[model samples]
Target: MAAVSVKASKGWQKPPTRLYEDNYGFGINFYQPMIDYLDAKEEKRAPKEYPHLPWSNERGLERYSSKKLVKAYSEKDLRRLVEARTKADHGAFTLTKPKTHLSLTETTSAVSAINRKGSTKEEVRVKKMSDDVFDDNMEQLASALRSAKAYAIGKSAKAIESHLLAESLRNLSSNTEVDIRSFQRRAEVSSHDSREHEWFMEQRKMKEEELEQLTQPLDQLKVELLGKQTSIEIEQLNSRVVEAETRLKTEVTRIKKKLHIQITELEMSLDVANKNNIELQKTIKKQSLTLTELQAHYDEVQRQLQVTLDQYGIAQRRLQSLTAEVEEIRGNYEQALRIKKSVEIQLEESVSRINELTVINVNLSSSKSKIEQELSVLASDYDEVTRELRVSDERFQRVQVELKHTVEVLHEEQERIVKIDAIKKSLEIEVKNLSVRLEEVEANAIVGGKRIISKLESRVSREVVSKTKISIPYSLKVSEEKYRHPPRWRNWSTC
Candidate 1:
């Protein structure tokens, strides 16, 4: 074993300096402290037996003790190990290299402990860890503490002052002296209530001035109305004066002329009355002849009235006879109408029967036409066969005899077909049961057709899918680089 020593001249001041001896082995404990202690052993010294845990054996402890193998990771332990490693380099042979991607998690049987938080229970747990593990955990804790200290130191003075100020304010508010008068003054000033009140007073003054001005216009209008009323009263007085003056002037003029004109007009009226008397005398003589003519015309009108009454009596008698004849004719007409209706109904029925017969005839004609067509075809065949038969008349005669015998047999078969049809009808009535089943049968025919179409479509889809399995991807990839192999089960093994 080669040895390393951590000297004390440096700052490390924990325990006494000890030798590090290499017993770096793997798959067993790699502690080095036991190894170094064992190396310090002399021949006179009896061997000291220690704990025999898995990591405390001679080989395990040696490897654990060696600075190269033992993973001591605290700042103190690591600094010691580094020095020991440097010293070890001076005296050592080969040493195992550190793993490149070694994780704290991957190192078992090596220091992998981390510091628990500072709680009573956590301290107890941390205290129970192995020395190497405890060292690593302490080193990590000390590093974290340093980082926390550095972070605390990095804060600005202003930030500290702000925090302190906020805390002081919170404390101050706990026992504050509030003066509502100050707050109310600030509220009233910010609200601008006094300025608003002054503005309101100014607006009210302006409105009062405007109201006074408006009332002045109303007074002006009232004065104008008074003037108009006074002018109207004066005009009424003037009209009354003019009426009185005109009335007096007309009265004087009438008094002077009224007597003189009245006398002259009376004389003229007598002359006119004499002239009217002469004219009326001539008119009366002329009207007397016209009145006599009118009397004669009145007698002629009365005679005509009498003649009309006699004619009316004759017409009334004739009308009575005509009415009697018309009543008889009405009775006959009613009978004729009924007969006409009966004839019309019969005609309609006959026409319907004719149409039915015509349709039947058309159907029969079509059947006959079909029979004629068959006969024509048979005749053509017969003509051809007749020629062939003429060529072999004896064979044809034998076939004719056979056909006659076959016709007789067909006659018997037709009778049997009739019997079978009766039996089938009887069986259908029992087996089909309900009359409603006929509708179901018809519906089934329609469903059967639809099902047939669906089945064909399914078959076509299966065919399309089958063909697409090979062709679809090829068609899609037509513009791409050609595949080295087409789709095959060999390449699709994973799929």
Candidate 2:
């Protein structure tokens, strides 16, 4: 919580300049006690023995050293000798451990002297005096006890003698005056002793009664303690039971929420499947319509091609008949020309008639060749059309196969949808039963604490919070646009 508080503070981002300067300010401040203890220890010690010994700083040591101490050491040449010895010994270069002999000589001598002189003499003196004195006290106590017994016996005998003499005097009443006076004194002392004894007995009885009265409250306190122990145990058991019940309630609620979420997810999945099925059906219908229109167009083209082939065949047949007629005419003209050649110089009329027949034969042969070429071109076009029709038929068969596969897929999807719907219905019934059970559990739950547990009276049950169904649509298309495939976040519905 402190860390959180520090993080929340504005100054956390930028600390004060003093924060870095104070070595004691950073990290844990728990060392305050240790620091105080060190300070206390320092306060108990004497002031610095060497004030001019370069107390806090170590640089330029000779400049800070007192002239008197420097002179004293220099005259004795002790400083140079110490430095020379330190330089000679490898270990002396660094003061890893103090020279025990030199550093603690005075301290060790003082401690040993104090212990030998003070502790030993005091211990021996106290031990010897205590033994002798206690032994004499024991003997003195025994002698005092013997003396007190002798004194008590003598006093009792004296009192008894006094009492007896007074009794004898009373019996010889009407005696001399001096005898009466002695008798009166003895009676008064006896009477005073008896009164004091009676008063002491009364006071002792009162003290015993007071002690018993004081002890009675203690017994009551014991009984009260027993009751308190029982109550505390009962309270502990009650608290444990309450904790267990609360834990169970929370667990039940968590399970219920998990089931609710699962149901919601399933419903959403069903919705998505349905929408996908619908879209698939629409696309299939559109594709089938397009295929049908294309097939019809191809069929019409095939019909037109067949008609053109028929016309080409007719044209070829007509050209054949014309060729045969032209052949017969060419033979007649050739025979006529042969006879005209024999009588060529004899007649101009025969020559003119032969020339006209030759021109007619040439025109017929040209027309027949043109008709044959047209027939060849028409046959090529017919073959091309037949190939196109065959390709179209193959394409139509492929389309049919694809359509069959799609239909099969659609049927499978439909079956799954039906199964899912059945499962959904069963789940709904199960959920209803679960909800009813939950309500019963809530109704049966114990409440009203301890007082209610002892009684068998009917109590009003608490209201159960029922889960409501939520219908959430799942659209792959929209989701793809918004979150893409493999969604990064959960889509939830309000319930």
Candidate 3:
């Protein structure tokens, strides 16, 4: 053993000095004071011993655990260790070679002291320690502390990465949820539109049925009115003879004056009839023109309907093509899903293989090289799989984006289709209304023609009666009797 002294000096006070003796050492008392200082500075910490817990005691010591021995840590110990490290970092610490050393023993040791001016002999005691063992223990403790700090830093970084991954996944899930909701809304809108279309179609059918019912009555009324006009004309012709005779008997005395007055009235009535006939002809021409214009408008409507049909056909073809493309994409997605499942299974198998390798590697030294090679191969495969998985994840994200876009496009198309359907329904209703109006106008025109014909017949009968009264002759009786029986077919073409 060797004796060593550590001298502590103050600026204005006598220097303090301490001596240390190495108990179990090969003349290592020269450096014992330094060892004592390290021990004291470390706060009398014991040599770090592994905690023999129940779990650890059961296994005693796994081969891997034995090789990878770790020191247990406490916060207070860590803080003291940091303070000591920082103290050492801020100051220059040098070990000086002690002077005066010859023989050393446990009891009578050589004094190797630090040279100091005005030093007092104040006795300082130091704890006994094995110099070699103490040195080895301090180095181990330092290494353990460094490993612990590194592990803590790595763990923190891993935690941060995991947090970032979780956030990304959450955002992705939220986006997917939004997309799903949009799709659901679109489906609801489409279903609503379909219902509306069905309702419109039903209304159209009902309207058509009503139009047919109305048309039947209108046709029947037209035929009945024409027959009534023909019977009224026949009755008026028979009454004309009696009316002419009554006029002749009443105006016998003033026949010549009456004849002159009657002549003027007949001429005026004839002119009025001509004027009315001309007006009637003009109205008929206008009505014909209106009918022609209506025909042209109907033709134009037909053309527009044909164009709409063509457009509908084109849209159907486009829809079919889009459906085919969607189906193809679905197939591709299924294949990708299968591949992803396979990759996941492979990853699980690789993880199991890695665990087995860890166990086998510890037990078989002769096979260590082979196991390392296999582990390298597995690591490469894992890396390859991880890369593939990353590619799959990217593809999945891209597919999701594409699906979202497609869904939006589909929604737009559905809205457009709904709008077109609404427009078509409106157009159909307008066309039906126009047809109904046209039918009503035609029925009114027929009724107006019947009324005009009746008035014209009455005026012609009165004119003939007046003419006969003014020119009563011997042949009038025969003519009147002949007029009583009208011809079988009263030449309506000439009339």
Candidate 4:
């Protein structure tokens, strides 16, 4: 069995048919040499014991177990039995074919038909069914057949084993008979010599035993190859299952992680939305308060605007009345200005007249001073004539005549002096009248005349008063005394 397993492992590298062909060629070459060697050594002394077969228990079973052999044989037999049974039932089981392609409606109808029929009559009814009915009943029939096959396989393990052993024995006997007949024919041809005949017979027996030994190992090799093939298939299936499981686990973990991330994102978005909603509500409240305040402020502004408009109208009317009053005052001021101009003109004429009167007074004062000097000389001459009259009587009469003429001249001079004095007094009265009129004019033209009056007074005092201070001679005073006392010469003239 170990050699067979080794051969199987080597043979797996090549195709089965190619390995079998190679083995057949090697067996032919190997046995030919052995056969020739055996014939040449047949005449020598036989060895004490023949060599053991290469497939003996001590060699083949060193690394193999009997339980594994039994299990493999059982499984192989079970599969063979199931195949045989299915082949036998093929004609009766019409629904087994074309089961995979059946429609829903067809399956339903077939299911109904099967449920209505008895188990004993099922085969006959199924045989009578048409192709459509076969398709319709395909799935259920296939499932039922699978269950039946499973049960039969479970119960028939020993029977399958016995059947396999019987078949192997029968094949071995048939091969032995064919080989023995060929060997007998060779023995018969060489029987002319009795010793050769016996030698051929012994050789035939050895070959037979060798053939028997070879047959058993070949059977074991076939079983081992079958087991190895089946094990390879099972290993492939197991690896596929493992790969699918790993792939499914990775896919499930990925999906779970993705779902967790999405959930976290949704929660964060919800929090942000809540914050935005709260902020919006706060803004709405603030806007409402501002709107109310603005409305109140607008109303207050409207009231103030109305009050300002009314005040503006009142101020405009007051301004119109004030303008009319200003126009009346302007007319009165113009009339007062005209009156002041006339008063100023009259005052200027009065000042010019007063200047003329002052010049006349100055001339009169100068003429009076000259007349006083002349009168003083005439009084001195009169005094001298009176003294000479006392000194000589004869010259007295001539002096009296001369004195009478002088007295007449003096009388004329006195009349002239009296006229000059009267003119000076009239001039003084005119100046007083002018000053009074100027005062009256100043009082009436009160706007610009007080300064004018003060200026006129200062000018009048400087020009008129300084010129009126005239000096009179003392001789005039003596002449006035003699005239008042009436001198003795005048008394003598009267006597």
TM-scores of all predicted structures: 0.18, 0.14, 0.18, 0.22
- The lDDT per prediction is 0.45, 0.43, 0.45, 0.49
In each prediction, how many residue pairs overlap at the backbone (N, C-alpha, C within less than 3 A)? 9, 0, 1, 0
Residue pairs with backbone atoms closer than 3 Å in model 3 (clashes): 2-29
Candidate 4 per-residue C-alpha lDDT over 1-495 given as tens digits, one digit per residue, 9 for 90 to 100: 122322345548774432332343334333544555566579564455553323333423523323232123564465456556555654332222232444322333443454443355433432333233333234334455565445434333344334334533444345335435545555666589998678667766775676566656544643564445444534543465466568878998999999999999999999999999999999999999998999999999999999999998999999999999999889877766665565445446645765664454354335434433443443423343334334322333343354354345435534554243344354445546555544443343342233333444455455454433422343555566557546443433332
Superposed on all Cα atoms, the candidates' RMSDs to the truth, in angstroms, are 60.4, 57.8, 76.9, 40.8
- Best-fitting candidate, scored by lDDT: 4
TM-score of 1: 0.18
Candidate 1: the clashing residue pairs are 30-63, 30-64, 31-63, 31-64, 31-65, 32-64, 32-65, 32-66, 33-65
Count backbone clashes in candidate 3: 1
Where is model 2 poorest over a 10-residue stretch in terms of lDDT? 486-495
lDDT of 1 by residue, 175-271 (tens): 1122122223333443556775565456446644754555454345434543454345345434654565577669868965886687688778878
Residues 1-495 of candidate 3 have per-residue lDDT tens digits of 235776665563766654534232312323444565667668765345532223323333343232333346875586467547734543221111011211111112212234333233211111111222233334434454454334434233334334333533443344324323433343444355777556545644664475455445544543454345434533443354345456656676579888889999999999999999999999999999999999999999999999999999999999999999999999977766665565445446544643553343233333323322332223322333334334434543453354355346435534554243444444345435534543453354345434444554565456564654434442444344336434311221111
